[model samples]
Target chain A: MKTSEDKLNEALRSALKRKFDDFGDQPNPSSYDLIRARLKQPRNYKYLLLTIALIAFFVAGVMIDQHWITTKSDVLSTKTGIKSVMQKAANLDINQAATTKNQLEENDSVKQSVSEPRTIVSSTSTKISMSSVVPALSPATLPTEQTNIVDAPEILEQAEIAALPVQISSISALQPESFKTTGLNLPAITITEALKSEPAIHTNSQKISWLLNLASLKTYQILTVPKSGDRNFQNFKFPSTFALESLGYKVSIGAEKNGFQMMLHYSTFRQRYSYEIAGDEYVVQAVGQADYKIVRPGTIMNEDNKFELLGIGLSKEVQWGGSPPRRSPQRRSPVRRSPLRQYYASAGVQYSHTLNAGPDIGWINAGFGRQFAINRTVLLNVGPYAEFSPLRLSGKGDPFFYQPYRVGISLGMKLVRP
Target chain B: MKFFTSNKYKDLTQLVRACQKHDPAAQTVFYDRYKSKLTGVCLRYAKTRAEADDIFQEAFIRIFNHINDLKEPEAADSWVKVTVIRTAINYYHRTTKEQELHSSLDYTELQLDSGDYEKMMDQLNVEELLSMINELPDKYRTVINLHLIDGYTHVEIGEMLTMSVATARSQFMRGRNMLLKKLEKKGIVHHENF
Candidate 1:
């Protein structure tokens, strides 16, 4: 007694209800659940082992520190004595210069005799003459050596006479005007007392050796010093290339001859339009250039170029804001102490998924992006993007597949700075 | 089903949490809820009930092992649906060539009354609806299944299938119309409504 239409509707509704109920009431195995549960035990065991290892490491570290302190004390004491002796030696040289000047002034006759520059007398004769005049000058004007000199006046005069020729010889060894004023008789004092102050003498030799070692350390060769010509090469582009050019940048390019090279120059606001292409396509011979400079010492900029091979594909050339000029192509180390503007530009094959009708379609994209800090934490990146794919052009059987192209922008950010 | 039988949605969440904590009872409870539904999903792509049962067990095992990869708990139903579909595709790839060799030979022939055909058609549910879909040629079945059952739009199906949106729409409509006619002739559906 149901109408045909009613029966059909009832059938459709019943079919839907039956589908929902078809899930059925039956028990199923939980093998995965069991495995997951079993996995927890091993994970717990791993954590326990890690904890025990860490505690053992910490205890070992404390024990090592205690042992290290005991062994270093002797070395520390020896260094302290050496340092004090060196300080005293330096002070002694200053006193010797003052005493020599006073002795010359007090005896004009002796000065007159010595003035000839050839009156080089024996150590005994010079000592008797200098000691007779020592009391004429104030104690302050005299050298601090007076304390030791008064105890053995004859020994002091003998030491001074013997030391005088050595000092004069060292001074005259200089080019004529090099020791014109304030010439401390340093060589004489340094050599004779060198035996008494062995620690100070050792310290002086060590200081000279340390300086020589520093000088001989492998220095970075001046492959190419930054020059005005480099800046001139960078100024080829206008400040801006497009409507939004105010947001763009101007870049310079220069090459050092250490390696095969090419250069690209462009504005930040414009397409990275310059490139040095050096080789053939089949057995492609080329040196690509993608270098950028920082506008400010520590700021970052978002700019880049897209490097695409005619046959292989596209690649990205990122221009970081703070990169120093490259003196050597092979050396990628940063010269500036602060994190030099970091950027990467690479040219290689790339792929991406695409949606199309008929046969499955995919895209090959070549592009690059720039990453730079807006602040300590946040960074901004932007670059040019291009995509290529094989598809129909117009009719059903076109000879050439449609190779659609798009030039757009890409943006990114760094969550952390390294 | 025992887990869902409690008639409290919160119980499902609690069971999932307990299972995550490695509780055996909770894991068993979680499996009971999804096994039958997953089995039916398996049956649609399988040639027999036994094959369907095997796929059902495999799918559950995979789900349990990879559950930690699921970012949103509430989306578990859709996640399971996609996993089952992917498993069916893998199953089809493995068995199709072997099955094709045997399909050329017929085991036996039997006479069937119109009543029997009608009875079988009457027993059809949504799972059977989906299974009948596999009977369609490859592209049409895939397009229609994606659009109707998986809830993908024509545009999304086009992207997935690498076809235009219009082509996806046309294929889906054609697949549905074919099912409507087949059901109508089997006397399971009355003429006026269809």
Candidate 2:
């Protein structure tokens, strides 16, 4: 049973053990120090990169702020150049004081009273009057026999128009300024026609006014809803939209043609809606028609919201003589009792691309607008506008009154295209 | 498996704790205790003594770094052995080589009984046998040394070297036959010696 090969292998194993019996090793003592010094714990390198990026962003923001302030000073310097140009133009009117006897006699209704029969040298007055047109035509210049009492400002406005190149057909638009404490002077619609004709007057005021009106304009708007149950609301009973619970902002840009304008606006706000749960307020954010997030007390859960409105509108000065024609007071219904002081009411059809509960972006904004003239070149428009998205016409007592609305305030500055 | 490993590693608690705390004195004791055994393991997979040294250093560094994460002090011996073995295998993979892992041996499917191998060992020179192992090809040397000298199972050898158990068994048997042939040619033949 003991093969010769087996016996040899047995002997070989014994010899191998005997050979390595004294085998040993001694590593250098310095190696331990080397391993210990370079010990590394596992770490996520991504987080380190992210932190570095955030610090870089913070530094860049500081640099941008410093540059922005420097640029703002440059804007001020440009504003100074404009003021100087206005002064130079005022000093150089081509035709001065053309008040002939026939010119005075023909316009018998709007006669200017000269204090004495002596020949008055108007050259001295003309130089002073040309500098500040508004200041020159005081109420004392109006004829005493003109029956309609008018504000001194309106008289000055008439005088300013008199200084323009075109001849106004009637001056009756200046009469209602005194008798009626507050209403738009209807005949001032003449100004829109005057602006449309492109008169050949290269006066500085006309040039500035034309440049302001020539192009599509952009405006910033602060969208707001009335505060809930405040004194302003009790008196006016405007639509209450304060329950939405956040600030809103809007931006609009568009072209104006013949006192009719169409603008595209994008607005952002916090859309909040609430319900009653167990006799307590359960505020919820409406992310979509079917999607909502429940809110607990002390939870700040206001998410940003955006909507687009394409509004086509027509504006006109208010009529003063008779009762305003009841051509269906359509625009006023939406903005009826808003407490804001408004002028020049306008009607417009607006297509809203709000986070729609029903159709995707519909003709939901049927509303009103109030355009206030800030200067000859700029205007501010603020009014309550209601979206028909939530309206149910079948409801009682004019469902229109129940519709909540947001206020859009747009600042329009004149632009000239090349 | 981690819990079982932790439970068994309890035996090495004092040594492991010292390594975890980075105690240089205890670390010296720990490293010295296993260095020779692990170096022997490293040498079997390495082509030369320099390669063996590199493998040994890398394995120990890994052992110390993760020593704190090992919960069972008693299993440290098995864990360190596996680490050194893995390090050697990894080193072989990382290096470029033309060496064949398994050499073809003669057809001999016979296995010797315990007494038969004992008699064979008694007749052979042990130094000559180890030197002949170094001369063996890469995979044959690895399989034979891991199986016979280290007393590892075929399954354990396959796991360490990333081979199937059957491949490990085949390489081992072939390595054994080749070693016997080499010894026979060196005039340490079975019947001739007897």
lDDT of each: 0.39, 0.45
Residues B17-103, candidate 2, lDDT per residue (tens digit)? Answer: 867776666666777668766776676556665566667777888888788878888788889988887777676677747666444
Clashes of each: 10, 36
* Tens-place lDDT digits, model 1, residues B1-194: 34475433365556566656656666666766776677666655465554565566556666766666777766777787788766665655565553222221133221333344345456565545555655654555555456545557889877766679987777665654454455545444443436
**Highest TM-score scorer:** 2
Question: For residue A145, what is the lDDT in candidate 1?
Answer: 35
Tens-digit lDDT string for candidate 2 (A130-153): 111123333354322321221222
Question: What DockQ do the predictions score, one after another?
Answer: 0.11, 0.13
TM-scores of the models, in the order given: 0.31, 0.33
Misplaced by over 4 Å in model 2 are A1-23, A27-418, B1-11, B21-26, B96-104, B108-127, B185-194
lDDT for model 2 comes to 0.45
lDDT of 1 at A192: 34
